[model samples]
Target chain A: MMRNLFERTGEKTLGFLQRLGRASIFLFHVLKGFPIVLTRPKLLLDSLYSVGVLSLLIIVFSALFVGMVISLLGYVTLVDFGAEQSLGVLVALSILRELAPVLTALLYSGRAGSALTAEIGLMKATEQLASIEMMAIDPIRRVITPRFVAGIIAVPLLTLMFMVVGIYSGYLIGHGWLGVDEGSFWAQMQSKVQWNYDILNGLLKGFIFGIAVNWIALFEGYDAVPTSEGVARATTRSVVYSALIVLALDFILTSIMFVEV
Target chain B: MTQAYIEIKDLTFARGQRQIFDGINLEIPQGAITAVMGPSGCGKTTLLRHIGGQLQADSGSVSVAGVQMNGLSRSELFALRKQMGMLFQSGALLTDLNVFENVAFPVREHYQFDESMVRDIVLMKLEIVGLRGAAQLMPSELSGGMARRVALARAIVLDPALMMYDEPFTGLDPITLGNIVTLIRSLSKSLGITSILVSHDINESLSIADYLCVLAEGKVVAQGPVEVVKATASPWLKQFLTGSTEGPVDFHYPATSRANDFHLEAKS
Candidate 1:
């Protein structure tokens, strides 16, 4: 029993290391193809149009609702302690710290990440990647690079939009409907919030989340077994795993950022 | 004897626990058509993939056009693949790209040719496949034979030294099959390229194959010139060539007892 346990543990460790190695190689390819992405404006524009502009409404709506709910929750709890005026501060902090980046990433993963994996997976299944390779073209440079660069460029921009819209929606709900004074709401937010730390940390989280989403999508697509069912499975796996990782990384970054302060 | 352009030495491949090809040895001579014919599930497509460098062998060597394929890097193998052409069973054209773009794909991706040069090459290849007027058509718009021809044009666009056709005549009417076979023969000869054809259309393939190989149970049961393969006494080869229902191939079906059970159940 002990021998079997040891063998299983060793196998698990080896598998983990192998996955890590593959991820590093994928990252290396993505980095190497960055220049090609810059040179190809059409590809970049297309990806931006797909990943950013098409995804704007969903991200904005989700963020607004999320912000309103968080503000309501903070207002109810603070009212119990006679601190209802702090709702603006609470909403601003939550939007910047947690809700905005995570919610936007989840929405983006569903729309952009699933599409990326499916498109690439289908290309692979049809041997289009083989054709590309046969033509001495680097698929990473031609196909993967544009998607990765687009994700990196798109996610941060989307997250910023999410934060702005979310915070405004929260303010509208709290001050306009909830009867909080407009003058005090802005005062409370400006006094209580640290812009540098909150904005920088959120942007950092967005960047990492973008990388994680694209990495998972590209890896799943690249390793996609060639079949109709296999491509479907890859698309689902990419979205699920990327969303999970985005949430996990958000928690880690949030704890690290606030714990020191 | 024609010089062996693509050589396989003790090639073997296994998928997980199942051995697909075991110690398979074959040579495709230069400037001639070599047809690999086998029953379904006999690893014919796998052999074509091996030659195209899509699948690697487990324990032996495969060399094409003086390049050792076993130890080459992925990029090196890709470079070698550029010198060869392949016609997939399903045509495998990119559905999103139109016919012109599909034919021009390899050229545009590989070479930095101007638009005029790319257009000229694409039109020329399409013309060779008798698809000059259908350059703007989508794959969905084309028939099976037209798609196959488009695939053929894409395959030969770079003027590859070797061409591998995987089931070129599959799922086609007799007329289309005949035309494709004729095109295969005339194009390979005129282009002076060695071709390896994997097909189940035995009679048609035999009409075109200068050299023929018969695979059964992961091994070469018979191989030689087309006339010699036809004269072989191997019962399996005879059954395959003659399309016999009662022969070595009957073993592929379920046991007689199970077949009898089905009949009895139908009667009851």
Candidate 2:
């Protein structure tokens, strides 16, 4: 039984390594298609419209509620120390440094990423990809790369949007609803939130999460089993895997960027 | 006899444990319609893929138009594929695009023609397939036969030297099937292109085919003209052509005797 356990572990490790290698190769091919995709601007624009524009309402809606809750909770807690004036600092710092980038990525993966997986998976299932190949066109270049570039570009922009809306909503709750001083709220947030440390790093984190999410989504679709059930499973895996990767990357990025040496 | 356009020799392939093709040898003639027929799951589509260079042989050669498929570089293979067209079993039209755009796809990919020229070429192909009026319709709006015709227009848009059809007659009404049969016959004659059709509709294929090839057990068991194949002495070939259950191809699943399977005592 002990030997069997070791053997199983070894086999699982090898299988994981094989998949990792294939995924890396897939990324390479996708990157190589970048030049071709750039020459055709319409493809990129269409992808942006689907993945970025269509996702705007959800991001804004979710960010507003999250920011309000954080502001409300921060106000109640800081009142104990009579330090309720620092509510802006708490709200701005949390939204910029953590919540905006992470939540936007999670939402993007659930919405745009899953749709991408299902679309590509259905294309494969229906032999559209093979037909593209028989037409002497590379499906990777024509289909996958545009969406990949769009996702990467869209995430950082969405994160910035999320940050703006979140901070503003926090202001509405802290000053408008609650009895916080407006001057202290703006003053404390401006003083505490550094552009380089908080905002720039957050955007960078968003960019990295974009790559992870799109990579997983595209690979899952392209490598799917090409059936209705297969596409469904791939869509689920794309969202689930991307959410996990985003959270894990958040922890690692926070440790590196925010942790004082 | 016409010169061979596609030649497969000693082709062998297996998917994990199931060997799909085993030492199969066949030749498709140039500018002629060759029908490849076999029972379901007997690798008719697999043979077409092999010829199209979509699937590589295990230890053999698949040469199309004198170029060995396995030996071409990626760019070289793609260059070759430009002169080849394949209609998938599902019609495989880009669902996102309308009928006009689907037919125009290959032309757009290969060249930078003016909008007018592209429009003219697309309309011409759609006209040939009797779908000119349906150009603005989406794939989802099309019937199965209409979708297949649109896919056929797309396949032939580039005027390829060779065309492959994978089960093109499947899942069609009798009228649509008859229309497809006539369209394929006329297309082959007018285009003067080598055509290989993979289908289970024996009568439809034999109606248009200049040659017939039947595959079973990973080999070509019968191959000749339509009349020759019709008069074949091979029981498996006869069984397949006539759609009879009694033949070497068993109707029952391979298992122990029924009594043994039921756990009954053996009769002495």
| Candidate closest to the true structure, highest TM-score | 2
Candidate 2 residue lDDT tens string, B113-138:
99999999999999999999999999
DockQ-based CAPRI category assigned to the predicted complex of candidate 1? acceptable
Model 2 lDDT tens row, A185-237: 99998898899989999999999999999999999999888999999999999
**By TM-score, how accurate is candidate 1?**
0.90
Query: What DockQ values do the models have?
Result: 0.47, 0.91
The TM-scores, one per candidate, come to: 0.90, 0.97
CA deviation > 4 Å runs, candidate 1? A1-24, A76-85, B251-268
**Where is model 1 chain B poorest over a 10-residue stretch in terms of lDDT?**
B259-268
Q: Report the TM-score of the second chain of model 1 against its true counterpart.
A: 0.93
Per candidate, native contacts kept equal 0.45, 0.94
